[model samples]
Structures are given as structure tokens and as C-alpha cells.
Target: MQQSKGRPRTAGAGQESSAERLDGHGREPTEDAGHLRYDDPWYDALASGWGESAGAGEPVPAVVAAARREDESRGAAADVYLEVQRSAAFQEVRRRYRRFVVPACVAFFAWYVGYVVAATTAPELMARPVAGAVNVAMAAGLGQFATTFLLTWAYARHARLRRDRAALELRWDTQELTRGVDGGAS
Candidate 1:
């Protein structure tokens, strides 16, 4: 009986030979069991920086410098963001948004809860026929849907009228600050 190279082959081993197990790369398996030789040309090309700009020699230093510049720019942008956050205009915008949202949420939730409570505790009030089969409950439920649509329209109108222009100006200012005169980070 012929013996396999390195370790002895166990009984009922799969059909793949040692060469096939090396991923068909034409490289032999190393003396260390389960380790294959790194012979792929693609990895070698990547290591040598193939297909990159011919003028830019040695990519590591350039990559490091770019990363350092990016970090510094991010730090500067964070400072700008903080300044914007501290500004009265930003504060006012946020305040207005919260002012509208908080009260609206409270009012809507109260209305919804009131409906639920009335439905549960006041069956006679809900069941009283208005015209034919339509009752107070049905009308109130339909009112809830109408209220949702109305609130949505009102919020949109409020944003368009009171908030959109201010927000847009703030965004433009922020962009100008972050990107300097030449459209690059100063």
C-alpha cells in the first residue's frame, strides 16, 4: 500500500487530493499541515499597487497623510457643529420644532385616549343612532381620521412657512463654513 505525503490519510477521506485542496492554485501544500503556499499573482499585484496612478509612487505614505488630514478636518468640523449648536438661531429652530411637536403630541394622545375611554365606558353614548345606523362612535372615529389628515397638513404648512427657510439658510451657512472659499477644508 502506498502512503500519502506528510500526515497519513485517514479512512474515508473526501475525494479531494492534496493538490486539489490547495484551491487549484498550482502551489504545493506546505510542510505545516493545512497551510498552503501564498502563490496568487492577484495578491502580489495588490501589494505592489498595480493599476494605481503611475506618478504616485509608494501609496502608504500618501494614504497616511490623507488619513491624518481627514482626521484634522473632522475635528474642525466638529468644532463648527458645536458652534452652530450654541448659536441662538439653531436653538430657536429646535425650540420651535419642539414647541409644535410636544403640544400636538399631547393633544392628539389625549383625544385618542378620550375616544378609547368613551368607547369602553360609555356604550349608550356610542350606540345612540344619529341618522340611521351612523352613531356618535362612528362619527368620532371618522373625526379621528380627519384630525390626522388636518394635523399632517397643518404641520407641513407650518414647516414650509416658519421653519424651511431658516433651516435651509442654516444648512447653507454650515456648508460654507465646513467647505472653505475654494470648496476645500481650510
Candidate 2:
């Protein structure tokens, strides 16, 4: 069998190497084979199975039980959240968002692409002076920025006017439902 000079390869060997058997520390094993080589007392005790079996079949403490109950309540609250997510109100909000965003994105992208194509293909037209030093290209480029801000304001206004109240009501309703399920303490 081929062998390396450092530690012997323990691939097919029955025993583990000292490195493999290290108990959370880099130290080699001591004279007592049962004791772990860890420097921390807690780690040594843990490795030796200390205090492990004491609470094996015991009932959970009140604090732990309360925490578990809270976790279960939170899990149930998550189900309430999911129900709200699947509700018509939530779906309507999403629909409104998509309705605005999709068309706006498509129009803006098309306008941008048209601007780029015009700039590249019709350089002479783009170079035509609109005012003093500002040309058609400059005006169109500035228009892109103006359109972006206008679209942003319009979207925000639409959301505020049309969807925000409904969506907010839905959120409040969901929160109330979850709080009720959690015994009115959210």
C-alpha cells in the first residue's frame, strides 16, 4: 500500500487518527483514554455525557413551555398571513400594482429604445439644434429623465389615491385576525 511521510492514512484502518479524535481542541489525547482532550471544562463535561440524561424524560419547564406556545401561536399567525395573502383584497392590490407597473415599464422601455435607435441611426436629426447649444438628442435625453420622475409621481399618486387605503385596511384586518388567534396580544 502507498503511504505518506506525515500521519499514516487511516482510510481502511479501524482506529481514527489523533486529528479525527480531537475533542473540539487541537491537543493530543492524554493518558486517560476515556477523557476528551478539550481545554474547556464545559466541553469536557459535555463529551463525558454529564447532565445529559438528567432532563431526558422530565416535563418542560414553564418558561420553555411558554416559549413553545408562543412559537406555535406565531406559526398560526403565519397561516393567517397566508390567508390574507390569498384574499381578494390582497389580489386586487397586486393586480392594481401590476396594471400600472407593466404598461409603464413597457412604454418607458420602448421610448428609451426608440431614443437610442434614433440617436444611432439618425445622427443628423439628433444633432439638429433645438436651442442655442442644446440639440434634439439633448432635449430627448432630458425628456427621459423628466418622464422617469413624472411616471414615479404618477405611480405614487395612483397608489395613494386608489390602492393605499384598501391595502392598509387589508393589512389591519390581517393583523387583527392574527392578534385574535394569538389571544389579543400581538
Candidate 3:
């Protein structure tokens, strides 16, 4: 029952405490739990029931199963995309794209380089008048612009005619496959 003026009463060497010892420190808890009575008070966080799992070894399996299910779903999605890519329809779409793009790129690049080389090496040819004021260089430059527009139109027309429908069908098929993974919801 010894007490200091500012400090609360500390446990005497032989004094018995009535409050339960939660964290094994035999220091008696103060009546006012909101206030800190001692400099080094006992903190039994587990006694407040905050840090507890759902029984012994029950939560581990549920967490592992959830993670494994997610991994399986992700792997299934990747497999679906890979299967579509390896399919004949997808190969045809890629082939059509390359068939148009490769030759067009080479032809346009060669035409541009030829214009530059001709303008640099044979300026007199470029300077020769096409009609009145417009020279060969001007005509060729205008042709470059015209060909760019024509190529753009042709590319759009070719995609619309050849690849777009098949690509759309592939996309729908892909979505259907993924939906099957989700048990085919409405």
C-alpha cells in the first residue's frame, strides 16, 4: 500500500494482486484504463481478441485455395489467347496484313528514295517543265501526296474487305471462350 506523491502505488514485494496477469507481468492494472498509470505498463494486445485467426489451420487452406483458383483462371485465359493465335483464322488475318503492308512499304520507300536521288543527282530532269510552271519535281511531289491518300484509302478498303470480318469473328470467339471459363453467364 506504499504510494508516491505523483506516481500510483506500485506492487509491494510480497503483495498479492486481484486483477488477472494477462501478459505474465504481475503489475496490477489501474482502475482508469484510459489513462497510463505506469511508465512501462503491460500491454496484452492478444487479450483484447484483435490478432486471432479463424481457429487453428482453417484459414490457411482457404487462402491457398483462393490463390490457386485465381492462378488457374489466369492460366486458362492465357491458353485461350494462345490457342486463338495458333488457329488458322488468326494466321490468315496476319498473312493478309503482311501481304498488303510489306509490298506497299517497300514500293513507297523505293519511290521516295528514287525521287530524292533523282532530285539530287539529276536536277536538270526535275527542273524540266511538266505543263507550264509545274516542273517534274513539283509533279512528283504532288504524286507523292496523291499516292499517300490512295494508299490510305486502299488500306482501309482492303481491311474492310479482307480482315475486319474475320478479326471480328475471332474477337467474338475469344470472348465466347473466356465466357465458358466463367461457366457461360448470360
What are the candidates' C-alpha RMSDs?
13.4, 12.2, 18.6
Cα lDDT tens digits for candidate 2, 1-186: 112322334547556466644533322467687765443332322233222222243321223445657778989999999999999999999999899989999999999999999999999999999999999999999999999999999999999988999999998898889889999785
Can you give the TM-score per candidate against the true fold?
0.63, 0.62, 0.61
Model 2's C-alpha root-mean-square deviation from the true structure amounts to: 12.2
Report the lDDT tens digits of candidate 1 across residue range 58-173.
Answer: 32222344555666777878888888889999998898888888999999999999999999999999999887999999999998999999999989988988888898989889
Q: Rank the candidates by TM-score, best first.
A: 1, 2, 3
lDDT of 3 by residue, 34-90 (tens): 533332233322342222232321111112344556568768888999999999999
Candidate 2 local distance difference test against the native = 0.73
Measured by TM-score, how close is model 2 to the native structure? 0.62
Please tell me which predicted candidate would have the highest lDDT against the true structure. Answer: 2
Leading candidate by TM-score: 1
RMSD of 1: 13.4
